[model samples]
Target chain A: MQEKDIFNLLTDEGFCNYCLKTNADDVEYWENWLEEHPSERENIESQKNLIILLANETAAQVTQSEYQKLQRRIQLSKKNNRKIFPLIMRWAVAASLIISLSFGYYFYHKAQNNRQIATTISNKTAPGSTKAILILANGQKIELSAAANGTIATQSNTAIRKTNDGRIIYDGDSKSLLYNTTITPRGGKFDLTLADGTKVTLDAASSIKYPVSFTGKERKVEITGQVYFEVAHNAAKPFRVLTRGQTIEVLGTHFNINAYDDEPTIKTTLLEGKVSVNYLGINALLKPGEQASVKSGVSDIRVKAVDTELVIAWKNGLFRFSKTGLRSVMRQISRWYDMEIIYPETLKNTDLFEGSTPRSANVQSILRKLEVTGHVKFKVDGNKIIILNK
Target chain B: MKKGLDYINEWDAFVQAENEAAFHELYCHYFKYLSFIALKKGFPVNKVKDNINDLFLCLWEKKGQLNNVVNFHNYIVSSFLRKLYRKENLEIDESMFVETVPGLQTYPSVESQYIAQHTQDDLSRILKIFVEKLPDKQKQMIYQKFYLGLSYKEISETNSISINTVYNTIYKALEKLKIEIGKENLSAFSLALALLSLLCLIYFQKIS
Candidate 1:
């Protein structure tokens, strides 16, 4: 290839898709071309690096809120830098010994793809997309995904509109409070804006019920499965989320609630502002960056600090698993892929998955990653994923 | 101007004058690189983010001593790696003979072509067969040099092996991959030709 041709390839989106291995056809074409033109290897490599670097930098852009959190961490570390210098020195000496021993472990386990399995199948179960069902108070149903980008429905003088960008908005005023429920089936999700201006994102296999207008003293919504809320501030009226056995009351804040019935506990994670989580007559106040977990049939609510990003990873289009168990991981995959997981009762493993992947990945890609652990295997038969022990 | 020169200028401003803007520029430049590297090395994202902030804070505080550093890119990268792995001699002087102007932007892309594709399902299946067949020591050497983007000298230091062994292992493994891929493509080409000829025969028979 000519130098100019190489430059064109560097700037081409096809080349980027090849570099990231996102598109299979692009990858095949590039690999074949590289094999034919060995002389352009150096140029190809450098350009590929530039592409990856650019992509990485784009993915790593700190949001305005995240930047403030990072600045705080840096400030705290600066204050403790001097005091911790000698201590870090002593710890470094001890850590080096452990590191040397662990170096072999890290190397051996880094690329451990021992048992290769066939991943490419003719049919693929794609990841979830924007789709949901809206139920009006009068038992009328609107399939929001197929509805046009305009007023889909109206309830009590409130204009229910669907934006072109796939968001359901409730505009205008309502004299009477008529409730509406938005439900997302498996392999589907939807975004909604309540009359009070609270923005809500419904994850797959989830539902949220809210009023057409806030005529009462408070804005309340009941949710199932997982939902993220960014409440519009109203000092006079408190915003409340009723989920299963727990109730979360917030004055205007961002939070995520994972209250799937299959899950062991209903977790309400607060991202911004304050909230009070009530479970079984016990109330636990939560500050920003805190989580309140209410277990089934338990009288008390446990509060702890958590990484809110991981809590709302679904809303951000990411599957971030940090020491998450196999069963839990499979549950997430099942919801996203809309597949039934069939595993034997005798199948019990203690493998903790630790990785992150984009939610836009296919079922095979997700399963392939899990297979890299060498502890589990998956056989995708039509709409079912059968987990096998290694 | 090249990206390396931009990085070098930012490094100089931060080290010599303690310019906060330049320091922030350098931080933004390497933050994702370090974060991705740490994550690849199996560090949790939250911990990696915290460690990156701490690493930059310490480097900022100690910028006075960072002057006179010849390769600012290598210095910052190796320092972070050493701190991360808790090993002292993770530095690579093998690329010392190369022109210093090119800086850090060149090496990370060298062998990551295959390493970057290690995540794709089909590509990784092919890599698994070849990489799993290699000896343990050679596999580690290839991984350190290619996947981790470490230099030969750094690999030798990390694995306590000779630089010659690191070079030979990586070189042999890469050659094997090239040969294997070439042979596979040759077979695929022949198969395609055979199928095309068969189709031609069928067309001629139909016309006849």
Candidate 2:
């Protein structure tokens, strides 16, 4: 093959080991071919780099309104940055360390911030893109990210189709009652409509285990990480989300759950409907625009009025932090950006950040934002970002 | 060409919140430079906006530590570059040496250089033409694979197409780029075309 043929293959995206998902045969052939022509190795590698160069160059120019939107978000963050770390904020920090739940939902600033950060992969884990893995009831795993859209699989009595906008839809009878689990990896997100028209948006490093057909008396789905659910209303059949340490029952509602194990608390925020959160032996009813916090070692769940907009901002692609601690903020960043956060003794436990930036942004952009607060400094080294003393 | 010290000094001034004007000035000054870099790097417009915005936010968040930064420009640029690379690029020095091997047809340098040096406006104009010319399905496919970096399988599932179709669509688009870069036998002619495209891009960008 000509060197250009090799170039063509390298630029083809899935032709190398870096592609992550490759045909074993193609990998074998290329492995052998490169070995035979040792000299072509250098050229092949350069071609691969050239494709990256192309990919890097493909970033679109920023628009006027988008810039203005970020400007607003920054200013708002600046306002929050000055927050005095009052009792509520401290409580939030304490709660976050124990679980993912913090009633500390930053209030909706009511500011119009439509900042959208384009996902960049050069440093750290790229922000979650539209990808999900679907595990069938039979334990057959379908890489939903790669399958053909329509009816990729028929689990039990449900037909699963990936929509053009990258949503998985379940359409069919609920007679089978077989369970299917959808999981989003560390840097992935996907929109899902369950067997009963319930819309669920799974955030990065999250999963939802739901029955393909909800045949029983109640609709139950278990979740880990953060998931924004807009449950389809049915008076006869209530939707219940079984999360770590708690169970949330809703007649029909919109809510979000942050249930990652590393978080010190479990936060479930109700947006547009009435929901009841049961944690340990205690139960708390939540009204619209309220958040329930289930703190570690605490038997009761605390419910409070919250700005639903701020709590569910991830669904809209914004990272909204209000009086959020450095650690808490970085926790969100590390999960979304898929980077390990290394802190020097200085930033390990100092400062509170307040603001909103799009999760689609490059890690550096966000890091720079934090650095300018004058309380923190950052250095991005490969996939790990080290926090240095100023 | 301001020195890194000057940039750091300005960063300090802005971080201290002693001079909002200095902050705005710094933003205006680096906005174009970063935009040019990002646009030249082929980031789309809204992202260019977000990239700059996010950097500024980072500056604000880490302002307390601005005094520690020795090279603000390199710091910012490296940070932005970090956003682009999931893995390290092969050493260019090695490739540069390999390119000089006698009779080896290095994939035309004219295109690579031209590609890397485009201004935001120039790229926007060219992409407008290029993307508009593509069939809707192909355009969507290109955006999904190149912009979103979705796997072919993800794209196939999303677009309701076969995995081969997804691969072929991207393969064809990239092939067009290869052909465009390979059209002429004479290096001088290809260089001339690249320059001509640059000129046309600049001219078209100015008018539009």
- Measured by lDDT, the strongest candidate is 1
Instruction: Please provide, for model 2 over A1-390, each residue's C-alpha lDDT reduced to its tens digit, 9 standing for 90 to 100.
Output: 344453443444444323222245555766676898897676454443444334333422222233467579877987776785476688888878766433223222222232222223243545667888999988999887888767788765678888887789988886867888999987788899988899999999999999887889899999999999999999899888998768999988888999988888899998787898998878899888888888877897777888777788889998876557778887888888888989775453346454567888777767766654325678888889898875
| Per-candidate TM-score against the hidden true structure | 0.48, 0.46
The best candidate by TM-score is 1
Q: In order, what is each prediction's RMSD in angstroms? A: 24.8, 25.2
Please compute DockQ, using alpha carbons, for every candidate against the native two-chain complex.
0.04, 0.04
Give one digit per residue, the lDDT tens place, for model 1 in A1-390: 345353442434355456665456767988887898887666566555433532332233331223456567768767877798789989998999899879978866664653233334334488899999999999999999999999988777999999989999999889897889999999898899999899999999999999999989999889999999999999899998999978889999999999999999999999999899998899999989999998899898889999888889899998877567778888998998889999967875666555457889788867865664325678999899998876
Worst lDDT run of 10 residues, candidate 1 chain B, spans B94-103
Candidate 2 docking band: incorrect
Candidate 2, B81-173: lDDT as tens digits? 444332234111100000011111122235444545543343334445554455656655554454344555666665667777776676566
TM-score of 1: 0.48
Model 1 chain A poorest 10 in a row by lDDT:
A56-65
